[model samples]
Target: MKSLICLLFLALLSSPLLAQDIFSSKNTHFSFFSSSPLEDIEAKTEKGVSAINIKTKAIYFKVPIASFQFRQKLMQEHFNQNYLESDKYPYAEFKGKVLDDADLSKDGTYQVTVEGILNLHGVDKTYKEKGTITVKGGNITAGATFNIRIADHRIDIPTIVVKNIAEVVAVTVNALYTVVNR
Candidate 1:
């Protein structure tokens, strides 16, 4: 019985789940753009954070709503006060998994699909999106671009500036991750 217990302990020690294969980044870049006949709106932020577990295929991302920067100050104010209600929602986040089952330890560029729940402006939506993850020399870089409809998130638009905003906005995310030392 002692020998069997020792064997089980060894097996658990060698399991991939026991390894430290998590990669994280605190300075992820996130952006969104809206183009309309009246005007084009764009915002970006580098204050986002992200993490990925290579062995478990889990991924996560978070960004403060107020972190986004706009070209015009008034537009930023409107985004926070009127559109997103940043004071109420505070943050946007995504929790998902890497679906392609690709080995991230190797050095290669892989196109993959990630399915997850995105919470924005106090709304949660499931998204299945395609993106590219490049692993080179233990460094990981991931990029994805997707669209979100404003109405789906319950973000209301006043009639006065309806033409200034689009119903759909294009969002892009880029993260450079380093291996965790756990």
Candidate 2:
């Protein structure tokens, strides 16, 4: 009985279904643009990290709040100290899954929908966004554009500068992933 149980355990451990194929990117690009009547604000960062599990269709991303760079130094400082409060909330994270049946192992382009919870400014909100995934020569690229409402995350914009910022911002993400050997 002991030997039988051991053999079963080994078989379960060696099962293909239990083995996960995970892809990761260390330098994912993230950017956001806010257009208002008074001014247009934009920021970009390449310090984000992301990972995806092909078999389970799970995806995750995390980016440091202070890593974003703005065109003007004062804007960047104000963003970190006043708007985003990077000292209090250092990072933003997303955990979601690909809601498509496309085979990621194959070389093709697939349109997908990702539904997940985004944690920003110490608030969590559910978002459903559309994205494109392209697979070529054993490499995978993912891109998405989504809009986020500032109030949804409790990001307060003072009335003094309200006219300079938009109520909603457009965010874009791009990631190139390579297979991770675990």
**Model 1 quality (TM-score):** 0.89
The residue-by-residue lDDT of candidate 2 on 2-93, one tens digit each, is: 34323323322322543336777778999999999999999999988887777777788888899999999999999999999999999888
The residue ranges of model 2 lying beyond 4 angstroms of the native Cα positions read: 1-20
C-alpha-based local distance difference test score of model 2? 0.86
For candidate 1, give the lDDT of residue 82.
93
In model 1, the worst 10-residue window by lDDT is: 4-13
Query: Per-candidate TM vs. native?
Result: 0.89, 0.89
Regions more than 4 Å wrong, model 1: 1-19
RMSD of every candidate to native, in Å, equals: 8.6, 8.1
Error of 1 at 111 (Å): 0.2
Model 1 lDDT, residue 27, Cα = 89
Return the lDDT, model 1, position 9.
29
Decoy 2 TM-score against native: 0.89
